[model samples]
Target: MSINELTKKLKNEAYSSLYLLYGKEKYILEYSQKLIVQAVLDEGSADFNLSSYDMEEQPIEAAIEDAETLPFMGDHRVVIIQNPYFLTGAKVKQKVEHDLKKLEQYLQNPSEQAIVIFIAPYEKLDERKKIVKALKKQGEVIQAEKMNVQLQKEWINHASKEANVKMTDEAVERLIELQGENLGLLIGEVNKMALYVGEGGVIEPSIVDELISRSLESNVFTMVEHVANRRIDAALRICYDLLKQNEESIKLMALLARQFRIILQVKQLKAQGFTEKKMASILSLHPYAVKIASRQSRAFSEEELKDLLIRAADADFEMKTGQRDKQLSLELFMTGIHKAKQTN
Candidate 1:
């Protein structure tokens, strides 16, 4: 099952006897766990019924025992078992031993009075294991993998609605730009923005611009945008600001080169009939990022991109060889871009 499906079940108060939640996305896994805990356990009796164990430090039998034991002063219990390394094909780093027979027995007759949640922070599980097979057959499984950008946007809209805050589509895109595609960080940013905007308030792009800290990667893109548009003054100003913050010119050059390289790749791929989704997967980039780069790449020809990359590489060589001052080389490179833009 996906996170969305699991969430629907939790909202409907559909509690399962055993849940096998595993994924590479930490946020999704943790969020699913929270939903399950909230749906099944009351706040007052949570302390007595809630139990967590690290499988790396303790044997699996201990958790099984906790799951089988009756709820304390409550009608049901929630047992959280973390880092079930036995489920994976990897070797365990710790000396702790797990009882496979005990776990297999517990899976066959899981307590009707308890909810056992096995949290595996792994990309894939050993599907061939009998224990894993039994759990899959007997328990509800939730794969908390990363959602695509469209799905993430849907979630953002849904989250804003739940927070009772109105958010425009532009605001949603801006939030994703500021925070990137990490759902966890984006969710936190949305929550903060919602609080600032208050109930029934609309979160605008301007509000996001004011609240979020622009990452260095974002700044580099902004600088490159200025260069692409022949806005030399703005580009130089951004460079100076970064220098004041102790950003090395060589490092900035490297970032600029990388950005241009990506744009070049995006342009070539687009020419080859690649969609943004396909480009993102091929380049291991966020779809939103690929979309932005695709638009930006259209502003320049392949020859122009290659020329800019060559300039960046030459500047790097000059800086390293001590033939030119690092800062001066960067400033000169910016000036060269301006001159090239005029000639075009």
Candidate 2:
């Protein structure tokens, strides 16, 4: 089920007896867990009704037993079964033997008085297993996967509303540009920005520009973008700021090379008729990154990208081998790219 559907059901207090939450997105998985906990137990009953067991250290039967147990002074109990590796194809060293038969039997007729949630933080589950099959038939399976750019924007809006602030579209785009697609960082930044703006305030692009913290990698991306646009002075200013912040020149060179490499790959893939979505999937990058790289790739020829990469590599070697001052080498590289852009 989608997270929105789950939210709607939970909002109506329609609780499921069995829920299998599995995915690689920890933020969504964690958020979904919190929602379930809030929906299942009140603050007063949570301590007595909520039970968690790690399958790595405890057997599945223990969790099942808890699920079957009656709630303490409440109408429902929440039994969280964590790290049920047996549900997946992964080969984890067994510290305790799980009674799959007991689990299978419990799945057939789960307790109506309790909610059993399997928190499987895995990319995929072993669907071939009988227990997995039984669980699929018996429970609601919610896959907490990564959100696309649109979904991410929606999340930002929702979070901003919850904080009693409004985020402009430009502000949302800027936040993603600066912070990438890390939901955790985005939400934290959103909350902080909301507090600064106060209730009923609107967060604009300028507010994001002033308040958001740019990572080293993000700064490098901006620097390269400036280089692509032939804004050498702006690019150098960012580089100097990093130097002031005690960022090593060698590390900066490495990040520059990585960004250029991505641009080169995106350019080649685009030439091969691959869409941005396809490139994102192939490159294992966020779609927004692919979008930025695609736009940045347009400023340089494939030959120019290759030349920039070679120069970055040579500068890296020189700095690491002590053949040149690290900061000077990085500056020369930046200037060199700028000069190349000018001559073109």
- TM-score: which candidate is best? 2
Write candidate 2's Cα lDDT for 204-296 as tens digits.
999999999996768888898898898999999999999999988888999899999999999999999999999999999888778889999
- Weakest ten-residue segment in model 2 by summed lDDT: 143-152
What is candidate 1's CA lDDT for residue 322?
Answer: 95
User: Relative to the unseen true structure, what is the C-alpha lDDT of residue 155 in candidate 2, on a scale of 0 to 100?
Assistant: 81
Please list the Cα RMSD from the true structure of every candidate, rounded to 1 decimal place. Answer: 2.5, 2.3
Tell me the tens digit of each residue's lDDT in model 1 across 1-344: 87678878888978899999998878878988998998998899999999999998989989989998999888889999999989989976777878889999999999999999999999999999999999999999988776777878887987898899999999998988767767887888888999999999999999999998777888888888898888989999999999999999999999888988999999999999988999999999988778778878977899999999999999999999999999999999888977887898
Clashing pairs in 2: none
Candidate 1, superposed: residue stretches over 4 Å from native: 2-4, 92-94, 243-250, 314-329
Q: What is the lDDT of residue 157 in candidate 2?
A: 91
